[model samples]
Target: MSSIGTGYDLGLFFSPDGRLFQAEYAYKAVENGSTCIGIKCQDGVILALEKIVISKLLKPRANPRIGSVGRHIGIATTGFIPDGKHIVKRARDEANSWRDNYGSAVPGPVMADRLGNYVQLFTCYSSVRPFGVMSFVAAYDDLGPHLYMIEPNGVYWGYNGISAGKGRQIARNELEKLDFSTLKMKDAVKEAARIIYATHDEEHNKEHEIEMTWVGEETNGIHTAVPDDLLQEAEAYARRTVEGGEDEDVPMNE
Candidate 1:
């Protein structure tokens, strides 16, 4: 007998039936958290998240939901901010080390691979529990834009559109309707907002309750500021979509 203490105390690797119960438990933590969305388009990638503040006092203290992991890579998460921060810091350190040694920005997929390995280690060790965060990593590499979803189990893959945290399926459904081949950055932004607004209820879908960022060929680093004009457009789109209007057409750039 492995002497399972509380049934939930069976370590991260295996449960009573050889199931990775701890990983599922971590995912449950994610399903109870805020929503984060990522959409990869021809131009680049966009990240949007709902800001769920514990209290009004911490509204300003909560900060933005996205972080820069490298010169061209950024990340967003939907659970355990501290865990996300720690993992991001580790990613930064890894990127910095790779740059110092190889004189290059770590490739987006390479960074994801390294982080996945790091997360996998925790799942195998009883001393530390798996991170309760599900993250989206956005990068503009030589191969163009890439989006990745990484879970507590260290599973990661490039994605066209993805959502993490509560109501993720709703968000993914919205993304599924998008044609990645023809999507532009602006259209992607509105879609990102729409995903969050749609996933969350009216109480949590207010404008101020949303935080968003994007990166692309024209935009460098993480973009936290959405122009007032653009934000209003996104809101209108979300509103119309909710009111059962037709989806907007993809913008064709010359």
Candidate 2:
């Protein structure tokens, strides 16, 4: 039976279709945000993002769409940036807690599952609004580099490569053409950057603004920004492809 609510606007009460209106709204928000890409490759994983700062006064952030959760685990996000941050912070906490308790880092799928639980708790009550965010997490472990996408409603999926946010369909379509089964670490990063440049609108399509990394053996992967020099190289390749320019060094792979 449909229960009566306080009759407020845009509340997250369950409807007959087994859907939460507020959660659907949050998904819509993600659909309209900047694009983020994550790919699981033979050697490791890579992430790429579109950078568009409205104010010229604001300095650029390398990983605006990405955040490190632990040594080996990282998350790429899109939608309301703050909500993404919140999810990132929680992922870090969970990772740290695992290390402290079991003396081991949490695996990628486990971390995603735990975070999904946290997100679902809020939906139990109408007082808290669902976060207007979605995350694509890249993690490495015994399974090697793993890619997973989680929605605001606690749904998660594993993928070889995935894209989210504004123009994501286009980006994903482009990404599907690449052979992730054979993609190496270096090439994966470059291809990710190309996808961002190829798909993002002119405003956010800035070269070298993307963040990337790979998972390695041992505990978790290092939670640091991908080196600037290599990132610059990838960005340059992307710029050439996006603008349809041809230089000896630029690869017109798009």
Candidate 3:
């Protein structure tokens, strides 16, 4: 059944088999996937995550891993890592397409919206299978900061802010305390760092560092990884809250 849609383009229609947005892959045992937190701001979006990768036997990988896209969209993924990488690639591809179609100089907000729309379509393609990848997509939208929580099922929810992985519950709880609607950009970053740090401490985990990405008017499509010094400061702050800090002093910037 095809229905005409008015407003923008009427040349698009959805098909089940044409695009299956489902995760049909086996889950491999891995040590760490990703720990991420996002903050929605008036100017832009802030996202942070710790990368922990494990070998086939569930042992931590020797080299640290950091997943980024187009230097603008920062994706900290959880769940199926390989799938996460695939998702990142998919996002990058969409970003490139938007650049090619609209112009090489697409705005950050436009890029974020394009990514979100792509994720939705991907989900539709997957149908009702199992999706192994889930990620926190934080970027700037025309209205300001745009945050989205993307699941493997292709179901994405626009959010003021979101966090993923082991420490998400702790981060979410902490985010509730802050007035996100009126919070400043700097405050949002610090809060995200604080919650992630607290989340690691509450779990008695050894991983201490949190990765971050920010998109704003100045930054445009250029996403900068958090500096090492700043992550150390955030870790110190998170440590004070709980007794005996055991979180590793890994550099947040990878």
Top-scoring candidate (lDDT): 1
Ranking of models by lDDT: 1, 2, 3
Measured over all alpha carbons after superposition, the RMSD of each candidate to the real structure, in angstroms, is 3.2, 3.9, 9.2
TM-score of each: 0.87, 0.86, 0.67
Q: Over the stretch 1-254, how does candidate 1's per-residue lDDT look in tens digits?
A: 45345765567656556677787778888888788888888898888888865566775525866888766888888888888888888888999999999999898899899989998887887888899999888888778898998899999988999888887889888889999999888888788877777887666444346677778865854434555567667867776787778555533233
lDDT of each: 0.80, 0.76, 0.57
TM-score winner: 1
* Model 2 residue pairs with clashes: 71-221, 72-220, 72-221
Model 3 weakest 10-residue run by lDDT: 21-30
Model 1 poorest ten-residue lDDT run: 245-254
Worst ten in a row by lDDT for model 2: 245-254
Candidate 3 lDDT, 1-254, residue by residue in tens:
33223321212223333422123221111113455777777766777776532235444322323356665566666776666676677778877777778775445455456555654554343233344555667665445566777665445777777766666667678777777777666556666666765666434434434556677654664566655666566656556544445443333332
lDDT of 3 at 85: 73
Tens-place lDDT per residue, model 2, 1-254, is 56335443367676764667778778999988778888888867877777666666666663356778867888878888899899999899999999999998899889988888888876667789877788888888777878888887878888998988887998889889888888777777678888887776767444435556556432235645666777788788877877878552444332
Give the per-residue Cα lDDT of candidate 2 at 85: 92
